[model samples]
Target: MTTTVLQNIRPWGAESVDLSIEDGLVTGLAPHRPGSAVPGGTEVLDGGGLLALPGLINSHAHVDKSWWGKPWVSYGGEATTQGRIAHERTERSALGIPSTDSTELVMKEFLRHGTTATRTHVDVDLGVGLDGIASVRAAAERLGGALEVEIVAFPQDGVMRRPGVLELLDRAAQEGATSIGGLDPAGIDRDPVAQLDGLVQIAVDRGVELDIHLHDGNDLGIFQIELLIERTVQAELQGRVNVSHGFALGDVQGARQEELVAALGEAGISWTSVAPPGRGRLPWASMREHGVRLGLGTDGIRDLWSPYGDGDMLRIALGFARVHGLRHDAELAAAVQLTTTDSAPFVHRDQHELAPGSRADVVLLEAENVQDALLRTPRRELVLAGGRVVVEGGELTL
Candidate 1:
C-alpha cells in the first residue's frame, strides 16, 4: 500500500499536525510521534498551511435541476412561471429525456466546488412522478464515491394543493428515493401539523429520512415546527428529521424563538440555513446562542428559491463566516463537523472522525494552521473514503 503522508494538517483545534495516509486513511500522526517513517509507498505532502477540514455536505440541493451554467431566477418572484419552468426541467432530467448539453456541465461544476455529499429534492407532482429524480440518481451513481447523493421525493407544487402528492412521495421512496420531502405546511393552507405527521409516517413506514422545506415565517410556521418537534420526539426519530429553509424562525422574535430552539434541541431535529444573508434579517445567531443543533445547507442550486450556490461547502461555511462574523479557526471547525459527523444523524450514518476505527473518511488540506486553512480555500490534497483515495488535488482516483 502506498502510504500518502500529508506533511502537516490542521484539525479542529486550529493547530497544525502532520498526518499519514495508508490504504486511503490516516495511519500515523506526526503530532503523536515526530519523524514517523513512510509506512509503505509513501509520498510526502506538504500542508502549505491550508485547512484540511472534512468534506462539505449540501444539506439542500436540487441536482436534477442543475445549474449547468444557466441563469437562475431571483427570489420569491419565482413561484409563478419560473416554478413551472423548473418543474418541467425536473421531469426532463428524471426521465433521462436528453437534457441540453449543459446537464453534464452541472454535475462537473458541483464537484469542482468541493461538495462531496448533496441531498437533492426532486419534483414529483401529478403526472410527472419523481421528476429529475432519475437524472440526479444516475449522475450521483456515476460519481460513485467521488460525490455521494441522497435524493428526496419533493412535490414542488404543493402537498394538499397538488394531487397525489403524498402517494407520489411514497412511490418515489419505494422507487429508490433515499428520503421524502415536505414544503410549507401553512403556505398552502394545508394542516401544517397534519402534513408533517403524514410525511413523518411515510418516512417511518418506508424506513427512510424526512427532509422538509419550510416557508412559514410567522406563527403558523412556528406552530408547524413545534408540532414537528413534538412528533419527532414522540416517534424517537432523533437525527432522522430536518427542516430546510425555516427562514420564518428569523421573523419570529423573543421568547418564542428561544422556545423553538430548545424544543428542537431536545428532539434532535435541526433546521438548515438561518436565512440568506442581507435578506432583511436572519435568525442564525439567536438559534446558535440558544444552543440549537443547526447546520448550514445550500437550500437550492438556482431557482426562484435561491439564486446563489455553486455547491461549495467551503462557500457555505464562508457564508456563515461573513454573516455571523465567525473567525477563521471556528469556520474550519464548522466545515469539519458540518460535512462529516454532525450530519451523520440526518444522513443515517454512524459517527465519523479521525479517531480510531472511524469509517476512514478523511480529507487532507494544505494549510499551516486551522485559521489559515479556512481563511483561505485550502486545497483538498486528498479525500479518502473507506481507506481508499477518492480524490487528490488534480487527480481523482476512485
Candidate 2:
C-alpha cells in the first residue's frame, strides 16, 4: 500500500488542488497550499498546471476483429451492412491475424491515448465460438490491472439466421461474459420479435446485460427498437440493456422522433453511437433529459470492415463533435461527457468523475479545460489507473 501526492493540478481545469492516491484509490483531494506535510518522503508528482480528468471510457468497441498492426486489407464487395458482415467473416479466417495479437496491439494503443476502461464486443458464433472472448480476455490480463475490459458476447450474425448462435451466446455468458449482444433483429434476422425475445430470455436467465446492435435505418430500425423496448419491459431489464446505433432516430421527424426518444427514456435504455458519417443519432440533450444515457466508441479500428481509428477516444470525440456540428464550448463539453461519465456504466463501473473517493483511474492532459482537451485531443501527460501511473509523457510505462 503506497501513497503518492499529485501536486498543482486543475481538476476539469478548475482551481488548483492536490490529489492523494493510496492503495489504488483516491484517498484525499485538497487545495494546494504551502508546507504540505510529507511524512517519510512521500512521492509527489508535479502536475505542472495540467488538467486532470476521469479516464476515458469506450462504451462500444470490437477488440476481437481489429486489424491494427496488420497488413492493410480493403473491404471488398457490396457496401451494404449485411454484405460487409459476410465479407468480414470470410476474410477474418483467411487473414489469420491472431485475435490475441490484434487485441493486444489495439489495447496498447488505447492505453497510450489515455483510455483506461472499455466495453469491447467480442464476436461469438459457431465458427469462432468463444475464441474472441478468450483472446481479448488474455490481452486484458496481460495488460495488468491498468485497463478494465467488460466483454459482451456479440452474435454478429443474426441469432436465427445462424444456427446454434443463441446456444453460443449462452455458453459465452456461462464462460464469464458480462453481457450478451444481438445484431439487427429486424434487418438481419427478419424476425424482430424472435430475435429480441431470445436475447432477452438469455439475458434474464443468465443474469447478464444486453447490448443490441441496430443498424437498420428508417422505419425498419424504429420497428426493431420498439420490439426491443417491449421485450425489455417484459423482462424488467430496463437499466441493464443498451441499444447501439439506433439510427432510425435520424430518419423520423418532429412528433415521431419525440415519441420514440421519450419511450426510450421511459424504459431507461442506454444508447451508444460510433458517430458514423451520414447517420442521425440520438440528440444529446433530449436523451439526457429523458434519462437515457448515451456513450461513444470507436466501432472498428482499421478492421476488415473499415480502415479507421487509432484507439484515441479524445480523437473520436473531436470527430463526433465535428460530425454532429457541436461547435460551441458548451456543446463540445457535452460531447466530452459521452466519452467519460455516460460511457462508464457500460464497463460496469459507477460514473467516473474527477473527485475524492472516485476510482483512481484518471488522465492528466496538456490542456486548460475539457472543451480545449476535446478540441485539441491534447497529448496525455500522465495516466493513472488504480492510482498507479501506467502512462506518462504520452507513453505507456507498463
Candidate 3:
C-alpha cells in the first residue's frame, strides 16, 4: 500500500493537478495546491509544473534483434525486405542478436526515450527457435516491470518456405506469447493462402492473436489484406488480428480504397506502422472514420536491417504526422495520442492515461502543450512506471 504524490503537473497540458498513486495504480487527482502538505510516510515528487503524459506505448518493435548499444553496424543489406531478412539470418549469430544483455540495452534505450510499454516482435525461426523469446522475457524481467513488453513470436524468415516454422510458432503461442507474427506471405512465401491459413489456424487453435507483416504493395498487398479480413472474420478473431506495414491500403485509390477500409473496420482488424519515408501515405483519415485502429512503432532500431532509430516514440509520432501531412494543432495532438492513450490496445491495456485507475506510468516534459511536445520532442524530465521512478532528468535510474 505504498503511496506517492506527484505535485504540480499538467496532464496533457491541461490545468495543473496533483496526481496520487498507490500500489502502482493512479488513485486520485485534484487541482494543484501550491505549498500543499502531505501525509506522513508518503513519498512525494515535485513535478516542477511540467507537462505530463502517459508513458508512450510502442505498438510495433523488434526488441530481440536490435544491436543498440554496440559499435555501429553499417547497413550492408539491400534495401528490400527479403534482402534484409537474408542479411539478418547471416549476421545475427555473430552479433548475439538474442542475448539478454543486448535486449536489456535496447529496453533501456526505450525507457530513456519515455516508452514504458511495447509490443515487440521477437524473431522465431528455424534457426533461433524460441531463444529470442526467452531472451526478451529475461530482459523484461530484469527491468523489474519498469517496461511492459508484449511478445509476438515473429517468423522473420518465411513460415511455409521453411519447414517446421509453423510448429515453432504454435509452440510459442502455447508457451504464452500474446501473439504470433507472420512476414510478407505473398512477397516472401509466394503462397499467400497457405501462409495466412497456417497463421490463422495457429491463432484460432492456440487462442492467441495474429499479427502479420504485409510489405507487398498495390494489388498484391491488397489481395493479401483481403485474405486477412476474410480469415479474421471466419476465425472469429476480430480485434485479435493486426496488419503491419500494409502498404497496399495506401496504393489503391478512390472507391476501391473506401471499400477496403470499410471491410477492415467491419472485420475489427487494426494496423501498426513505423511510418517509414517514401512509402505511400496510409489512408489514415478513412481508417479513423471506419473505426480502424492505428498504432505507431519504432520497428527495429540499429538492427541488421537498418542502422537507424534511437527507440524514440516521440520522433516516430512526429514522422507519422509529417508523412500524413497533419498540420492542425488537433491533428498534431492526435499524433502524440497515437503513441500513448490511443495505443492502449496494442499493449493490451484497457486504459493508459494520466487518470485515476490507470497504471501509474507518467512522463513529464518541459513543454507548453501536447502539440508543443510533439513538435520539439523535448527530453523527458521524469518518468514514473508503476509508481517507480525508472528515469529522472533524461537518464535511466534502473
Best by TM-score: 3
What TM-score quantifies how close candidate 2 is to the native fold?
0.97
Distance from true location, Cα of 118 in model 2, Å: 0.4
Q: Residue 186 CA error for candidate 2 (Å)?
A: 1.5
lDDT order, best first, reads 3, 2, 1
Per-residue alpha-carbon lDDT of model 1 for 176-246, expressed as tens digits?
88888888777763777668878888888888878778766677777788888888888778767888877
lDDT of candidate 3 over 1-398, digit per residue (tens): 89999999999999999999999999999999998899998999999999999999999999998887787888897879888888999999889888899899999989988999999999998888999999999999999999999999999999999999999999999999999999889899999999999999999999999999899999999999999999999989999999998988889999999999999999999999999987837989899999999999999888898888999999999999999899999999999999999999999999999989999999999999999999999998999999999899999999
- lDDT measured at residue 166 in model 3 versus the true structure, 0 to 100: 97
Error of 3 at 289 (Å): 1.1
The residue pairs in collision within model 2 are none
Name the weakest run of 10 consecutive residues (lDDT summed) in model 1. Answer: 95-104
Residue 25, candidate 1: alpha-carbon lDDT: 49
Q: Residue 162 deviation, candidate 3, in Å?
A: 0.5
TM-score of each: 0.80, 0.97, 0.99
Better of 1 and 2 by TM-score: 2
